[model samples]
Target: MKNPFARSSRNGDDGPSEIYGYRIYMVALSATWASAMYGYDSAFIGGTLELPAFKTSFGLNENDSTSLSSNVVSMFQAGAFFGAICGFFFAEYFGRKPVILGSGVIFAIGAAIQLVGKISALYVGRIFTGLGIGSHSFSDFGSITASTRTFRAQAQHSGEFRPRWLASKNQIVKAQKNLAWVRHLPVDHSYVVNELAEIQAAVCQELELSGEQRTLVQILHECAAPGVRNRILIAVMLMLLQNLTGINAINYYSPTIFRSIGFTGTSVGLLATGVYGIVKMATTAVFMIWIVDRFGRRGPLLVGAVGAGVAMFYLAIYSQLSDSFDRVPPSNSGSQAAVAMIYIYAIFYGFSWNGIPWIFASEVLPTRVRTIGMMCAVCMQWLAQFIIVYSLPYMVASIKYGTFYFFGSCTVVALVFAYLFVPETKGVSMEDMGVLFGPDVSILAVKAQENYQEFRRSTAMAATEAQQEKQGGLHVENA
Candidate 1:
């Protein structure tokens, strides 16, 4: 049987097909939401730590501040690290949805513990939150992979139908040709020529048809074979991109960022931090609704890096100027400027980097490897987070505002990496993506369309040969 969706190769081979847009959007949206939660959990602590009750209760001091901060902040990353490590095994064993749900429960529990005012308990909460984020990250990637695979399968099935449909239409044309043959029966050569021309035209139309629909038809005919290798590559690239963004650094050190922007008073700083969390959550909600679908993944990422870099540079400059002037209390104008920069940073970071990386990471891998790949990527991110959280205060104190310069520099590096490597996957389906990006598969999904066309041709040729053989058998039977 001929697959309708397969496209014809130049050498007459059939290939995979493309997917529709709506299906891609639905999968990406669901996967991106998981990332939003990831962002929320990572950033929520920033504001809470700024609360005076939090400070006095913990007996924080300048000398022990960094250690205390690291102790509190690092737990989540530590949990995340372990979670990601464990996620690989669970995702592989249980599938994506269950892992995501499990993560959500962990995150909710962590948030509940923090809300209850137990400083020690907060660490336990952070661990659970981290675990959830890590596990969910893997699950999300798996979901996208599954979605892409489905799209590819659909396209392939569509390709298989094209040839059969065209063949059915040709049956009508062939009937016309037979009638013409009978009408010109007295004119032997003329009747034969006309009949052949009609058959040829029908054949040509079948051969010429190509596109995603065509490839789907071919795959259907071929029994919907899986495109395995392409799925792995997509997962790997997603993992790399998620870590390369440096999102972890920003999430881990948002409070330090608030302080650098002139909110040095612990009370004011913590309040601002909580506000930053609200902004992150709010912005992520907006992104899930409006931006993720409209702009594609790379646009928000580039915009975010630029925004973060500029804010960091401003903070760095302000730090240097304040230190150089021996300004114990900043001038009102200077203070206002710092506050404004911090807010801007918060808004920008919230909108772009907070939710997008998780979304991209989750949707890029296939079901089979989604868990392992997500785990690897999330672990790398947490490790990066651990470095930033553990060392940020020391760097800030030693270098003063110069620390901002370093972070700013890192932002530029992340931006460059994003532009060069990230692909726009806003509306790509899971299954079709498998064929589109599979190892040695064509990146141009149109190739699947071509594959579909080729399959149709083969099916037609086979059907024709079968018909001839059947006719020969019938003649033999009659004799």
Candidate 2:
């Protein structure tokens, strides 16, 4: 009873070890680009919304400003909600690649609409952009999840299983014992009894499968790979948290915030907002390539949260100082300090919290549910954005600068959330993600790895048996 699934010892050395590789980096880079587009679309409106050309053309007035802003922001989010709903269907049907490409096209179209609409003050253009962004966000989530899952699956399939050199002797002994057991199994037992015993043994020795059983083992492994499912849950949770950070308030209200800081000119404020977008893009790129892989997810999140909180606190203080200056008619120095603090706030925001959260949201989820989860996450995020953007002007007008303190407090909460819940996934393979999250996290990933091992063993054993048959044939010919 020779084992048909076992491979020769030589075949065991063909796989590679786990370390960061070029292909994996490339995938991450592509996903990062998708996230950048999301940031661009999201933040661009904040600057452009304030242009007199935009305002007058759109029939915007100070009286209805908050409502108008809310409508615009919320519409984008509303479109996103529908897009996420669509992602669940598309991701399952079309696979990851097509959905992502489609998303990009949709997003680009949305941006294009905004660009065209800006000229005519047509609300239709803004709505079109919102539709694209919403749809694209859904596709982006699916793509990132699929890409990560594929990487993990490939890694597990081609990964080396390097048992210790000292363990080779033990392996040999174990092989001998296994062979002995195969030989001793009763060949003349009652057929039914023997069959029943074999079934029981197969169930018991689930991890140590036989050569003929290798196919089943491989199937099981494929089912267990980590990236196969649960991505949606993680994506949704993370995205929801990102929205809760209140960064959208800053994005949607940048012009007003600048004005409050003493930048009286509309053109200056708009220019500053554009500069903010550039800073966000540049800083996100740096974080993705150098910082994300180095510091891990939690560190940046915490650092960003704390830094944002401090900045917002300064904003609140600056607001109060300006009010005092107005009352007391203080020197120009106080005004200058207030203005500098606002710019400082923007810089800190661009560097720390704004872009990084979106990246984090993209990376953490498992493959099967990634698109659905991302859509859910982003939907909640946009909805939150809508609320904050819509409410901020009124809050500022009614409560003065006290709204800054509220946002700063929320940043502290975001910090705590990141520290407690978010795992560091910096360099971990997608296949191994199940192990990191928990044993039950990724059934597909775990199963996939197991199946691959079983398939390898089965193929090896089959080859060995074929070689042995050929040798026997040669011996018979000589006789």
Candidate 3:
């Protein structure tokens, strides 16, 4: 059979390719390890802090232990905030691969330092680790998704794309191989020819409209462009909302949350918390693989907000009615119900809010300023995370069951945010995002996708005809 991407005398029209496919998963799995590492490190502290041995080893049970534990738990996030800023400069100077490699090395150094078994040393280690993780996270999450989507989308429209981080010959060659892998074809294939032509046309059209600017200062200014600015707003809000949902409260202080609900003994609380992790892992897998692209980002976020809010509301009401005013209640049917509610909340969270924010941020920004914009957004995310992590212990102590109410109210507001601000990005090309979120977008309009897609196709066709005529004239002259 003729290659689907080829013209083959059939008028070069195969329509737009599928927005997502197996190739995306293959590329994502192979490339996005920093995301997984970040999750592993973040979750490790939750169960670790609960360990009696760990407490003894770190002298965490000594005087002012509560404050100490909070510090230990929160220090990483503090460091991550600064690390995100460092990431912007690192990417600016060194490019993407060096950032990845440097982040890994720094994380390893921090991990090794933690193994020395001294609390003072661990504190220093955690900061370095946080720095590494924070630096790695912005580049890893932003580049893999944005670069992949932008590359593929541009590939579908233009054919060949020069990567932003082609610092050397080796990097350029690697990028070409990666692109070929994403296309699931040999580099020299006729399918590649058509794709390259289309991509070039799109690039040409874009160039005619704006001059290229490569300076870091200029790119930083580009971050203020209306389309980029709006996306940055969306990304920051989504990330802030993500933490405000209180996922970190559950993650970092699960034993405390579990104990507050009903479960007695560290083992019981940890066991229940272990179950929460299992459920999260399972459901997150389902969402990441199946629901995200199929169901779209906005819908799941809306459903997750309402469902999680309801679960938290149940927990709050249960705690209020069934428990003592000053301390945690004993294990009863209501506490059991609260435990179940926690599980339910996890289900809602795992299916949507957990993963969608990163995806949204990755797709929303323009390629030139994507890393800087994401660095700013990820900094906000870490700041939000730090606030929740550092403050939750105090909030739970002061307000008791009222903490759930606080989180629940936040989720309710999140519902409004998703409905009003979150755009459905499924199947939309990166090139089209500016137009999608452009000033002309009407808040009342239900679907702007079809209208804008038709416009892009018409423009692409005109650019393609111009390219073909140029190539034809060159061929005749050479002959």
lDDT of every model, 2 decimals: 0.58, 0.56, 0.74
lDDT of 1 by residue, 12-99 (tens): 4222222233434454466546667766656666555655666777776557666667778788878877887777677544544566
Worst 10 residues of 2 by lDDT: 158-167
Query: What residue runs in model 2 are displaced by over 4 Å at the alpha carbon?
Result: 1-37, 104-121, 142-237, 324-352, 355-364, 439-479
Question: Highest lDDT among the candidates is held by which one?
Answer: 3
TM-score of 3: 0.82
Residues 1-479, candidate 3, lDDT per residue (tens digit)? Answer: 53343322224544334423466444445346777767787677877877889988766664545676578878889888898899888886777668778888888898899899988888888888888888888777654453334433433443213343541223545545555566666766666545554444554554444455456666766777665677888889999999998899898888878877667787887888888988987898777754576788888999999899999899889877866446667766777778889999999999888888888888877765666888888999899988998888778768988988999999998888888878788877677787777756643214555456667799999999999999999999999
**What are the per-residue Cα lDDT tens digits for candidate 2 across 1-479?**
54332223333631233222344445445643566665665666766677777788766677767766666666666666666666556754554446567776776666667665443333555555555556656655434433433333233332211111112223434433332232233333343233334433433343243222345345334334444334444445555556555567766777777677676677887786677656655665565444555676657777777776777787788778667423432447766665555556555555555555555555654433334446567777666666676677677777777888788788788777666656555555544454555445422333434544554578689999999999999999999
Q: Is candidate 1 or candidate 3 better by lDDT?
A: 3
Q: Show where candidate 3 strays beyond 4 Å.
A: 1-27, 143-164, 167-178, 181-186, 193-210, 324-328, 442-479
TM-score: which candidate is best? 3
TM-score of each: 0.60, 0.63, 0.82
Question: Where does model 1 exceed 4 Å of error?
Answer: 1-44, 47-52, 55-60, 96-125, 140-255, 324-329, 332-334, 431-479
In model 3, how large is the Cα lDDT of residue 317? 90
The CA lDDT at 346 in model 1 is 65
